[model samples]
Target: MGELARALTRHGIRVRVVAAHSPGLPVYGKIGDIEIVRPRYWWPERLEMLRREVGGLPVVWRKYPLARVQILSFFLMHAFVTARYAQSCDVVHAQWTLSAGAACLGRWVHRCPVLVTVYGSDILQVPRHPIGAWLTWLVLSCCDRITAVSHALQKRVVQLGVSPERVLVVPIGVDVTKFLPADDVHRENLILFVGSLIERKGVRYLLEAMPQILSVFPEYRLVIAGDGPEIISLKQRAVELGISRQVDFVGFQSQDNVRVLMQRARVVVLPSLEEGMGAVLVEAMACGTPVVASRVDGIQDVVTEEVGVLVSPANPMELAEGIRTVLFDPIRWREYSYNARLRAVKYYNWDIIVPRFIQIYQSLVG
Candidate 1:
């Protein structure tokens, strides 16, 4: 979203980001030309823990049952602020399905078109619950257009009875210039994993596979970045596997730090059980780093045989083999490194993607 706002502003479009309030960030501020408004959803401000984690509200709700009270307030304030801004904007673009439900309310005030972009969970996981399905349907029914991050997500939206014409696949863009290969261009004996340490991310499987991966490449180390609910258990599992020394849990990383890591790492791995589209994979590829990810959902769309290796989702042995295949083979690794950069620039670069979004906005506005 920060990238999108910056890109939009560069193209002479004014952008205002209205988001859920966080603890330290100011309620109103400016990042360059972009306006940011974070509406407060809960009272006694310290109790505002709804938007803290990677999983957002669902994770908070499950961990602290009392936080459920803030859900209603979040929706109300979100809708009110959205409508407040909607009165001035040319169009309203919401990033998630639940947020779109609130953004849609702005249509009642401004009568402007609303477009919601589904990342992954909103269409895939949310609809599994009975009430969630009804709410999702209501949200979809209210939007003028829908944009999915991947074709897999688009198919899921279509399954929910949204018209194919109403939905388009527009992935989040990456700044390729900033995420470049190291100037020295020396790849290290490091395997990198970046994302929330969640069960669905399949990080445990990566931990399980590390023992086998280390036996062959003892010099190599697995660097797990990003923290989540599974961090503690994942650390314990690493100890049990006796590959604790071979793995380093770096917790969350800033984008600049991740870029530097990606540039140096021999391979960036994302062993996700499910994904809308692996944004991290694209970023790694941009850094001329080959990937070893699961052969599931939109990951397949990003990783190709020319760029990297793909293995079965939950199988540790296959993942180990996949990692070894890229690690040991000098010719394949070099080819993957070269092709990875080309593929990322051609498909996922912000230069290529942001224009597509501008087109979408023009089509709707016209």
Candidate 2:
């Protein structure tokens, strides 16, 4: 969204972004001529209400009923706010599937063109739920244009009945300046993983592979960054495997912190079963850190042999072996690290990506 917003702004278009209230507000605020409207929520009050309702329900009933209500409320509230804010815009550009649903409703009421971008899970995972699937179809059919982050996602959108001509592939761009390599290589005994602690992210696989990794390289330490619902379980698993001492769970780090962490580490790892474009992989590459990722759709597109090592998803043995290969061979590591930076500058940087988005927006609104 930041990339597209900046791209459009550069082309003499005033861009307004509506996002959830959280981190990264200041970054958006600094973008000249762009208006950012973040929806605010009274977290304490909301949490109290949620707690009251949740306490009354039986465990079985609490799962689906409460989940459905919360989701519905979020969609309705976002739709209401987005419609009001998007009234003056010529086109509504939505970033995700839920946002697309909100945009679809907003466009319907205001009679504006709606463009929805699908970035993996929004098309693949969301559509599996009955309500989400219905909303997915509605947004796909109503949108003026459907942009996907990858060709794989474009195909998924088309399979969901969106027109082939309306769908465009526009991968997210990396900020070359913020993510470039450190001035000097300070070799450290660190292996870093930066992403959500979800099962699909294959965090469990990383933890499972720890024993093997430690057996061969006892001095090597694994740094797990980012937090999610599965953190507790992951921690428990690490303890059960007797590798908790070797794992460092560094909660969530800022972009600057992540870049620094990537620069200091020997290699970065992402073992996701599925991904949109794996933006962090490029970020690691941009920082001159060799990556070991799954050979899944989005990861495959990003982590070529030239830049990083690709292994089968959810296979602990393969993941461990791949990490070993990169860590043991300094010659191979140096070559991959060099190529990774080159790939980031050539293909994945914001300069290249932003222009492509500008072309899309110009073609749509001109």
Candidate 3:
């Protein structure tokens, strides 16, 4: 959403981000031309723990059961604020289903088109439950247009009874200039994994594959960036596998650091059990780094035989083999790197994606 806001502002579109408040962050601020307003959902501010995790409501409901009460306040406050802001906006563009639910309320105040973007679990996992299915259907049905991050998601949305004509696949774009290849920097014998340390990310399987990856390329090391609930267990698993020396858990990284890591690493890997579209894979590709990711929904839409290897998810052996294919062979790695950069520039760059968004907004407003 940050990228989208900046891109829209660059094109002279006024963007105001209204979201649930988080601790330590100001209730209102601005990043360049983008206005950010984080509405407070819960009272006694410290009790506001709903938006703390990477997975949002689902994770909060499953892990911190007591924190689920905040959902009521979150929904009420989010909808109220969204409706307040809707009066000034031309279009209400919500990023996820939950956000769309709130944005839909804005129609009561200002009769404008609401665009719902389904990224992942909101359309995939949430709809599996009876109550969630009803809510997801209600939210999606109420929206004027829907955008999905991948073709896989578009098919799923159509399956859920949305019209095919209303759905379009517009992936989250990456800044090619910020994450481009550093030809002057020497590539190291490092395998990079950048994402939350969550179970769905399959980081443990990456750890499980490291020993095998080390057996062949002893000098190679694995760098795990990002932090989450799975950190302690993942570290323990790495220690148990006796590959602790070869794996570096560099907690969380800023965007600049991630770009540098992608540029320097020989192969970037994301062995996710499922993905919305694997923005990390596109970022790696933008850095001219070949990827070795899982062959799962959304991920397959990005990775192909030319730019990267896609192995079965959750299988350490297959992950190891995929990494070895990129690490051990120089010619194959170079070919993958070249194609990866070309594909990223052609398809995933922000330069190419922002215009599509402008068209969508124009169509609705016109």
- How much lDDT does candidate 2 score? 0.79
User: Candidate 1 or 3, higher lDDT?
Assistant: 3
Q: Write the per-residue lDDT of candidate 2 for residues 1-366, one digit (tens) a residue.
A: 675677667657788888754333332353478888765432433431222321112221234455445555556767877898788877788888777788777666766777788787778777777876777888789888888887778887888888899998877787888787875547588999998776678999998987898898899999999876678899999999999999999998888899899989888999999887898898899999999999887676788899878999999999999999998878998899999999988988777877776677667778
Candidate 1 per-residue lDDT over residues 1-366, each given as its tens digit: 788888888778889888889777688999888999998887678778886687656678788876787888888899989998788887888989867989887678967788888988778788998888888988998898899888899898888888899999998778888888775347789999999988889999998998888889899999998988999999999999998888999989999889989998999999999998999999999998999999988787899999999999999999999999999988888889899999999999887888888888888899
Tens-place lDDT per residue, model 3, 1-366, is 788788778778889898768877788888887878899877778778886777556777888765778787787788888888788889999999888888887678877789888889898888898898888888999998999999989988888888899999999889897888878357998999999888899999999999898999999999999988899999999999999888999988998899999999999999999888999999999999999999988998899999999999999999999999998888988999999999999999888898998899999999
Model 3 stretches with alpha carbons more than 4 Å out = none
Local accuracy by lDDT, each model: 0.88, 0.79, 0.89
The 10-residue segment of model 1 with minimum total lDDT is: 179-188
Q: Please provide TM-scores, in order, for all candidate models, with all chains considered together.
A: 0.97, 0.88, 0.98
lDDT accuracy of residue 71 in candidate 1: 83
For residue 100, model 2's alpha carbon misses the true position, in angstroms, by: 1.3
